[model samples]
Every structure is written in structure tokens, then in C-alpha cells.
Target: PLIVDASSDFFSRKIDFSNIALFYGGVQKNAGISGLSCIFIRKDMLERSKNKQIPSMLNYLTHAENQSLFNTPPTFAIYMFNLEMDWLLNQGGLDKVHEKNSQKAAMLYECIDLSNGFYKGHADKKDRSLMNVSFNIAKNKDLEPLFVKEAEEAGMIGLKGHRILGGIRASIYNALNLDQVKTLCEFMKEFQGKYA
Candidate 1:
């Protein structure tokens, strides 16, 4: 079965799922909520359970048959998801959202590219992610912690990268506006000027 995990890019753009048997993702990233996972399964695929011995709670067919109400749901999170959907619709849907996301990511990538080697991007240019921009100091790697500290002081929280990566990561999710991104770019410039 062709299953996909769209955790990062969910709702960021249009996806062609014609060949997918199951598409699922957590709503916390782009969908503006937590504690809920959205799943889409082809109807015919539900008939091919891995085992009939599987418990109802773990069975795809059980949940599908019950319309996703086999158990109690996170009511508040579901409501927030609905509100987020309305927001996306009000903003003219995924196409428009995708454009904004692309613009935001490009602005950050440009900052990294024009940093004069002060900042280096982790991903190759073409393989970069629109949702999260990961980068680090090009020369003084020791200053990464200080950078994250100063960024938080400037009211830009959560710029810390993953523990394994141990650098800077700015998550430019759907909720961030272009002006906010510009502010971050400005911060990057000022930070570079201070120490570069």
C-alpha cells in the first residue's frame, strides 16, 4: 500500500493522491492544532486489513465504519481544525496559501544565501522545505546558542533547531505573515552585522 506521512507539508499546497492508498498527518504543523491526526483512506483499501485479529480500536475498517467515532474525540482540537480550515478557505484556499508559503521561504533562503558566508543553509537549494528553514553560522558555530538566545530576546521564539541538527531552524508555518518573515530577515542581518 502506498501510504504517505504528510506531517510537515499538510495543507501547504495541492497534492495529487490518485495513487495513494492511505494519506495521513498530524494537524499540529500547518493545520493549527494538536492531539488529532487526519487520515484519508481509499474505500477499497479498508477491506484489506492486515489481520482480522486486530482490535477494533486499531482496525482501520472499524474507524472507517464508525465514521471516526469509535472512540471519544478531542472536541476542542477538532473545533480549532475547523476554524483553521475556514481560515484557509477565507484566504482563497491552498493555492493562495502555497504562494504565501513559497514567498516566505524564499525570503529566508535569500537571507541565508546573501549572508556572505555568515549563515549556511542545511538543505540543498532545490531540496529546501517551505515550512521549516534550517541553517547555522558558517564560521563561528559556537555562536549558534547565542543566536538563539538573542532571537528569543527579540521576541522570536522557537528558532532552535532539532537536537540532532543542533543549529537554527525557523518554522515558517501558515500562521506567520510576510511582515513577520521580513522581521526575522532583519534580525538575521543585524545579528550578522554584529558578529560577522
Candidate 2:
């Protein structure tokens, strides 16, 4: 089983072929809400499960047999999934979504690099996530809250960093447009000018 944090748009990244079974995450950065999780499995693997007598709710075969209508699945969650899927399709499917995400992340990274140590990115440059642009302000112990406040004032919501890693984290999901990223980049420049 592959344990993935798909909630943060990890699916947009390149998939390694070694993965066999992909599990689900309940929150949405890509999936788009709470109480909903999506699982993807290889069809060949399902055939092997035929001999196992797993509980109906726990068995993939049972769920497939019932067409995922098994055991009173969350109705509202399914609706939201459909909505998100439609939006994704309208945006030209996953390829376009990944392209836009890559562009947005590159824009943010460019701004961060231009900050000349005033801005620092959290993820390793090689393994940096395209979805969550995690970073920190130089001397962030003083600049962190101000950066968040200024971002909020500039109409940039959710620019605050994760609690586990204090600093700023801009989650650039598919729903976030390039304009929003440009706005945030401009704000970052302004903040750096004032603080650096």
C-alpha cells in the first residue's frame, strides 16, 4: 500500500511506477473537501482478492460489486467529488491542472529566490513540492506574522505556514489562479522591500 498525502496535490507530481495500491485522504487540496477520500487500485490486484473473505465494507470487490453505493456512503461528499471532478474536467483535465500548478509554483519560487535570503523555501530544492510552496522569511521570528497579515490585507488568504513548520506556506492548488499567485508575489516583493 502506498500511503500518500494526496490532500496537498501530491498527485500532480510525477508518479513512480513501483506504486501498487494508492490509498485515500479525507481532506482536499486536490480532492476538495472533508469526509471524502478516493482510492485507486490496479485491476489485476483485485482479481487476487477473490479468495479472501474480507468484510463487505472492507473489501474492494464488495464495493466494486455494489458500484461504490455500499453501506450508505457519504452523499454530500460524493456530490462535492462530482463538482470538483467537473471543475477539473472543465479546466482541461489533470495535464492542464499539473501545468498550471507547475507555473504557479515556479513563479513563487522565482520570487523567493529574488528575495536574496530575505525569503527562504522550506522544501529541499530537489524535492520541493509544487502544491505547497512552503517557505520562511529571513529573520522570520520577527517577520512571520507581519508577512501573513500583509498577505491577508492584500486579499491573499491561507498564506500562513503550517503549525508543525512555522513560516509561510502558500498552498497553490488547481483552484488558485495565476493572478492570485502574481498578487502574492507582488506582496512578497513589497514585504521584502520594507523588511529586508
Candidate 3:
């Protein structure tokens, strides 16, 4: 029954913790691989679960009591998470990550805005996600598939938009560098010139 919205990039934005019982997310974005999930919980809230008698594997207290060394933990995953955390700390922590991600998203949005309605965005302007830039081709429904195809031909992968949203979605996750965004923007401009 815990409502956890671990959708957005953590470093790029803050989560309002007004009434939340727990905060949990996969470490793949700001941290590392998809196999690791990190959780943040209040100690007082944890005390309330003491009488629940959940299975040892499912109980946080069991893991805490054993210092997370209980029953052969995911060693490889934890190692990877440590490596990622070290790398993140070396890069000046989450602040630097946030700054870089913001820059990349801004660059793409600037290009889209300058397109003069040739590029259409899917998400609302205010609610648009910094991690995933979703948009579509304006007035050219046929160009959507071509855009996906040509982007792939240009050495860009994962440019295809999500199925439910349709159109084009550029997921500018933290792992994606600014140079990659520039490369994508160049391709976008080229595609716009050809199809728009």
C-alpha cells in the first residue's frame, strides 16, 4: 500500500516527502544498473513493522540486524552500486549530475522550441520530464517512423518513442552525456530539414 513514485530522475528533482512512508528506486539512473533497488525509510516507521513477523527474506529488520550480510546478498549488484557511487562522488556528487542533466534537457528543448512548431512535444510544458523528453513531429505523421529509422541509421539507439505515448521520446538519462545530446540534436535538425 506504499505509494512510491520512483519514476523521475532523483538528482534532477526533489520528491515532496509530505506524507510518504518510504522512498525507493532503482539505482540504474543516477546510480548504476537495473538490478539494484535502494530504499530510504524512517527508523520509527520500521519499528512499527516489528510485530508483523514477515518472512526473514522479506523483512527489512532481518537484513538490518545482519548489516545487510544476511543470507548471501546480491554481491555483484552491491559491488556495482559501490562502484557507481564512487564514480558519482568523484564527479562532485548529485549536484553535478543534476546540472549536466538539466543542460542536456535544455539544449534539446531549445532546439525544439526553435523549430517553430515543426517539433511537437507530448508532455505538458510544465509537467515535461527532465529525464525523458517526449515529443513528436508536427504536421507530419508519416515522418515519425522515418525519424526513428534514420536516427538509428545515424548511430543513435533508443530514439523510438514509447508505445503508449507514441511519436518520439529521447530519454536523456544521467548516463547520456552532453555530447550525445548534441549528436541527437544534430540528427534532429537534419531530420527536420528533410521531413519537416
Candidate 4:
């Protein structure tokens, strides 16, 4: 069985694909829009892919042989991915990007952690997400509606939590620069002061 790394989870925290048999992630997660995915497979793993009889379209070796030009590619999406990669590299590669991501997550998480019962973080401290900071209002949970409403009114959007895990999910993706995170954090502080 090939070990798979779904880089969606802790990718921003750290990325070390060397030890994995396979790794994959969608650009939608951080790089760009949807309809694009990046995958990596070890050379030995590819050579040993047991199912040689599988159709070429379903074979990694075939794609590798053709440099992923086995068929028409998602040209536009790939272009966008390249642009994003260039931007990230220009900003000092993964090290600097990860540093900024960590800082942004920290700013938002700190706001949640220091709210003194006004905001309650969803994940455990050790398990908190660096990409999506999920949390909720402590006392008047009902005020979550008002909170989301006011946040939207204040020019911030996409803070509502999923239904399965209702609350707020501040997605601090790589594309979001530090200034944006600071604004969100500032809004969090102002909202807490007024409503908490």
C-alpha cells in the first residue's frame, strides 16, 4: 500500500515529501483555483506500480513518460499554478512563505486564545490548524450569527464555519498576505470588545 500525503491538512506547518510513497494536493487549497492538482510519486514506487496492464490514461508511468502531456492539460489552470509558484518563489521560496503563513495563523489564533471566554477555539491547542483557524463564541453562542453578520459588514467575508463544525473558520491561506491577516485580527479584537 502506498502511503499518501494529503497536503491539505498541515502543509503550511511543514512539507517533507521525501519519505512518502505518494503525495498530492489541489491548487484550490492554497495555490490557485480549483480543477488543478499536483502529485508526486517515488521513482521506485512508479516502477513497481504492479498494474502495468492498466490503461495508459490510468498509468503514472505513461504520464511521466509524456511529461504529463499524455492528453491535453488544463492549460489555464497550469498557467495559474505556474504564476503562483513564481510569485511564491519570488517571495523567497517555501521557507519565507511558510514563515508568513505561520505568522498569520498565529495572529488569528492569538486573538482566539486571548479572548477571555469571548471566543473559544475549536481545535485543541496542539492540533490547531495553521491554514484554517476554527473557533466559536463562548457564552452567547447564538451571537455567532450576529458576529458573522458584522464581520461581513466590516468588509470581511468567508468566516462562517461549516455546518458539521459550526462556528468561524478563518482560512489563512498562502495567498492572503500579512496585512489581510492583521486586518482580520484587528476586526476580531474590535468585535470582541463590542460584543464579548
Give the alpha-carbon lDDT of every model: 0.93, 0.79, 0.80, 0.82
Whole-model alpha-carbon lDDT for candidate 1: 0.93
Backbone clashes, each candidate: 0, 0, 0, 0
lDDT digits (tens) for residues 70-136 of candidate 3: 8876778889889977877777777787788889999999888889898988877787778999898
Give the number of the best model, judged by TM-score: 1
Which 10 successive residues of model 2 have the least lDDT summed? 9-18
Mind sharing the TM-score for model 2?
Answer: 0.83
Model 2, CA-based lDDT? 0.79
Ranking by TM-score: 1, 4, 3, 2
lDDT of 1 by residue, 168-189 (tens): 9999999999999999999999
* Segments of candidate 3 deviating more than 4 angstroms: 1-3, 11-20, 48-62
Candidate 1 TM-score over all chains jointly: 0.95
* Total clashes in model 1, counting residue pairs 3 or more apart in sequence or in different chains: 0
Q: Name every residue pair that clashes in candidate 3.
A: none
> Worst 10-residue stretch by lDDT in candidate 3?
5-14
Provide C-alpha RMSD values for all models, in order: 1.2, 3.0, 2.6, 2.4
lDDT at position 127, candidate 4? 91
Q: What residue pairs clash in candidate 2, if any at all?
A: none
On lDDT, the candidate that comes out on top is 1
